[model samples]
Target: MDCCSPSRRQALLWAGVAAAPLAFAAAEPGAAAAAMPKDALLVTDAEVVTVTDSSVVITWFTGSATQTDRYGAPAPVPADTELLLGEPGNPGSTRTVYHDTAPTAFHHAEVHGLDPGRTYAFTARSAGQDAQQSTLQFPGTGGSSDAPGVFTTLQPPPGRYLFTLALSNDLHMGEQTAGIITGNWPPAFQQDPGLPPYPEVMLEALLDDLRKPDRGAEVLLVAGDLTSEAKPGDVARVRQLLDGWGTLGTDYFVARGNHDRPHVGADYAACTPIPYATDHHDCWGDVFPYPRQTLSVHQVGGLRIVGLDTTTLDAAGGTLDDGQLADLAAELRRDKDRPTLLFGHHPVTYESAVTTAAGPAFDLDQTKARQLEALYHRTPGVFLHHSGHTHRNKRTFMEESQSVEFLEVAATKEYPGGCSLVRVFTGGYQVNFYKTRADLARQWSQRTRGEYYGIWPHYTLGTIADRNHTVVRDLSGLTALRPR
Candidate 1:
């Protein structure tokens, strides 16, 4: 079936329902449920992903069927809300499977002929109750003469603009080992006590910080390794973590990383090297599928953000395949004039001796790196490539191009409780690394006699400022970097 066809759309709706067993239970009437008041409310996890003068996709979810009707002038309400499937806008009513569930009780509806740079306050209703109401701002253009509704609209400032995004990686949800996991056998794996399962903890803290009014970051891009061992339970845990943060307005995107694949064997290292196993492949597909890529020609003011899935090879380390690379090239070609930022799990290039010592090793495919570099050179917008793996704080500038910056992020687990906060402004981009609030860093430092290699000690500062012009910043006060 055509994936974009109407039938395929129906299938997507059913898939949502099949995955949510708890939603089904909540929908059922119970003795206790009868006592609770029933008011029509929109059951939605709605958030704004991308916004422009002409279009927007406000993604949301619902417990049951809903209706999108106009209440006041600019706001919408439920006219005749009920649990109905496949009725006009209600594509979710016909399917019994969980996937059939819709993000909202309804899907995308175009608010056509909208005035530029206007703010519209819209609400959703389910079971004849108001579910959610939020205002969306549209950037206006110069030539528009018509105004549709009495809403406030603002246009983006003229000339080039910069958008800021947050980068995080190697969450490793259920993984037991901080370093490599080597032991007698599978049963021996039971003996290994993991260093710290703090990925979730740090993620929550980092998110909380970002949600602050002053953070100014509107987009979040996770480079990959969201879970350890690609187990369904682990994937579910990661989902719960993200779902908890759904309220934040940051638009989130993710790419598949090495550890995100299912457990193949003790030797199975990167998700890109081997074909996925039977049960495990589905889990990965269901949780962290590849091509989670997003491209914004005008992300953040005028800059473009290109998110790539570099770990598409197999279970082992590999770069993007030829077809994916071609697609990437096409995308770059489309927006060659805009400054572009690349986000992915693997680095296009690196020169780290310490990471080389690790078993599966660090470094992107040399041939692929050169290919991508050539593409970047041809494309004017490509300025920075952000990656995370080999959990360490490091930055490398390609001498060949001098135009591209390769930034490696520290893992969220291990010693210095890894978290990086990135801010973009009209001047330039600033990245501040914060040590996790947990005392694990100090404890590890004391126990290892300064030999703690798991977490680097130099990122303890509450903030770090990066001037747009300088590639190197004085991190002296931020965190002391130990000599390699």
Candidate 2:
């Protein structure tokens, strides 16, 4: 709700940008003209997002409305936006990506036809100002570390053919926390939810996208944190929205999140509590009727997916007691060759530059993470771990384990708002993030780009398939199953 408008530090915002003087100027402190000229309209908060092997997007803000807080969204800029691109240091080779006719602050331009593992240069001119001279670096294996602004592209998947799965998380139904609950941003931003409750509207769009006749996804996977405060109304609301997709427990699968864990609330206490051996659940005991158990297994597309309740009674992070770990270990031992994926709310390991929610509570505790890593070491069938707590798109290849691919999906309800569609090919699997197609989802995503020091959107929304990725896996175990 911290949607305050600010102005100041307009020069500081773009001062240390990665420009090398080809198109943007490097500001020197104490120099009268060298500084960003207080009144000058220069590109600030420029970034590349939604990157893929064939394309990349560049965005920036114009105007003097600077963000003065560490964790809030700023209002849209007061001008139109445009961008220019070309070979680094060569303006003549430049081509225009696109242009905006309307005067809007938050501007983005997607440049297509980029080769994988290649590098090119470009400049973003918006608000009548140029951002740091940047390069369109594609992803490739084993590149020089010394190269500046080099981005690596994911390798192709292992095979081809098969059904796909849709994955999403952190819907945070009924919570007012901005980033924690998508679409609940500051009022000053003036982003209309299009439909009354923005979260519900956005979630509906996500499900709608998954049901598209042409979408390859055959199963729906909700990682966790389905509700904000685990309210009965909120849980019911989420269930109602999900009903649009199909019958629960069959069309889609879910796991528990900290926010959905059992808690003490009079309003949510009416339903009978589900039985838990350790008494660690909240109102969830009575909330969710299907997938009745936190630790449950489901089969889809010939893959065995495990959902766990990592949330402890009071910790923000998750805990895997010795007993639970042992059980998981035993499960893997039973069918070591099954194509398996584990879904939970808190990630095993999450990295974020912004101190949005600081604490070990933000991720799996050290002991649990180590245990999971050790478990992954021997579980070759485990190809992926999908989690949601961080509400950002991050794919970490567990080099040590060399088996599981860990992906942190963006929140479904807010900034960088969208869900990930995973296309499972016999050769390999590819995950592409998509914002809910509703106009409200688009407006909220653009408006909240200023969250977490104005650079928040860059990470949550992901840069160059950073949020979207393709992985090569030993899917021979799945070869026996045909796409249903």
Candidate 3:
């Protein structure tokens, strides 16, 4: 259970802090003095939320120069927003521009007619002012080359798109605050007084976006952490909201996370109790019970989707009991060639663990993690492992399971709030992260962007490639679950 030394985690955390603040003024000479003019509308946190072969959604925040929020950060201000895009390095190229004349603080623009597999240079402007000194440059580009911005469109998926699967996690329902990371110096973010809970706003936004025909997600996989603390009311409320979205067992599925594990308390006395911890009541279990067993498989057309419960009753780190591991191995052996997507709460790669301050607790225990990795190594059918605990967007590949991508997504209730759409095709598949675009969702996301010294984006907004990309595999085996 003691997977990694705390000394190593502390060392890595310090190293990350030292190297990550390069975006701050203290790390960059003249950055503080070169701050935007007080009167000029400031545009910052511009990022490509979702990128397909033909389109991409760009979102950013425009702050009011004359006003501030209760947190003492610049408040959102109305401004004209536009997207300037063209072929990378080709100023003379016929530029394509999309304008949202609505004059709002949280800007969301969708650009279409982009050529497949081509790289484009682009930037978002507000009131004709650019974020020239933005600490968080657009997702991909950085340094002097940020001008005109840069991102490569995903190459088309290998074949016809068979179905779309929405991937998201860490809703953290019932949590009253956001960005509560370590000490008091870095304050947490909270909803303004009297406002609906921020988590509710975000969850509704995510469901609305997924419901749109444009997104066309036939199934949804919420990796884990459905509740903030496994509170009974919160657990039931989460289920009620999700049931409004889709049927739990067929249309959508969820896994357990550390936060959703049962705790011993009087409030949960009426809830189901776990055998592993008999004194603890399982509120999460009572609301959304596992279908057949803790580890179960569902077939979508020809693709095999395995939902694994990785949370442990006793600790924050995750593990698979001997029985569950044996069940997974047997299921994989049932159809060795079937394309499989396994999702759980905790990440299963060593690299994902060290990157966060939580270290071992941020991931599955090394013993079970390696066990899962080795199982995937022998199972060519397993192509992806989706998880959400680190609350960041990171794509990792391990030598033992080179074919399976270990993906960690950011929380859906905070900055960069959104989900990824997995487009499964005959030849391969693509994963595109889409930040929720609803009005309140975008506004709340912008507010939370100020978390962690305004360097939050530096850590959470991963590279453009990490958010969107295509992979070629022999998925000819997968048939359409629903028509596109």
**What is each predicted model's overall lDDT from 0 to 1?**
0.45, 0.61, 0.77
Cα lDDT of model 2 by residue, 1-484, tens digit:
1111122232233233313211222232122112335455435656554444566556565533333222233333445556665666566887766776666555656656677655566566654456552223333222222123233444546665577788899887886546321233222233343446667766877887677754546688888889876777888888878876766777778887877766654654565554663333345545465333237677776788887777765545677767677878888888888888888877775342122234344577766787887887787788888888877776665544446777878888787677777777676687777666555565566556545434455436544545656777656546433433
Off by over 4 Å in 3: 1-38, 94-96, 133-148, 182-185, 291-293
Ranking by TM-score: 3, 2, 1
TM accuracy, model 1: 0.52
After superposition, the stretches of candidate 1 with alpha carbons farther than 4 Å from their true spots are: 1-163, 184-196, 213-216, 247-250, 262-280, 289-301, 312-316, 350-355, 359-361, 438-484
lDDT of candidate 1 over 87-153, digit per residue (tens): 2334444321112222223322223343546555444334334334222222211122212212222
Q: Could you estimate the TM-score for every candidate?
A: 0.52, 0.73, 0.89
- Candidate 3, residues 1-484: lDDT per residue as tens digits? 1122245555446445632221211111112112446463457767667778989888777765544666656656667678888766677873548887787778888988889977788877877776443544333311122233676677887777799999899998998877654344346688878888988899999999898887889899999888888898899889999999989878898998878887777877898777756897788888888721279688887788899999877566788888899999998988888899999988888877766556666578888888889889888889999998777887887754458888888889998898888988999999888889888888898888777656677777676666778888889988888542
Best by TM-score: 3
User: Which wins on TM-score, candidate 1 or candidate 2?
Assistant: 2
The candidate that achieves the highest lDDT relative to the unseen native structure: 3
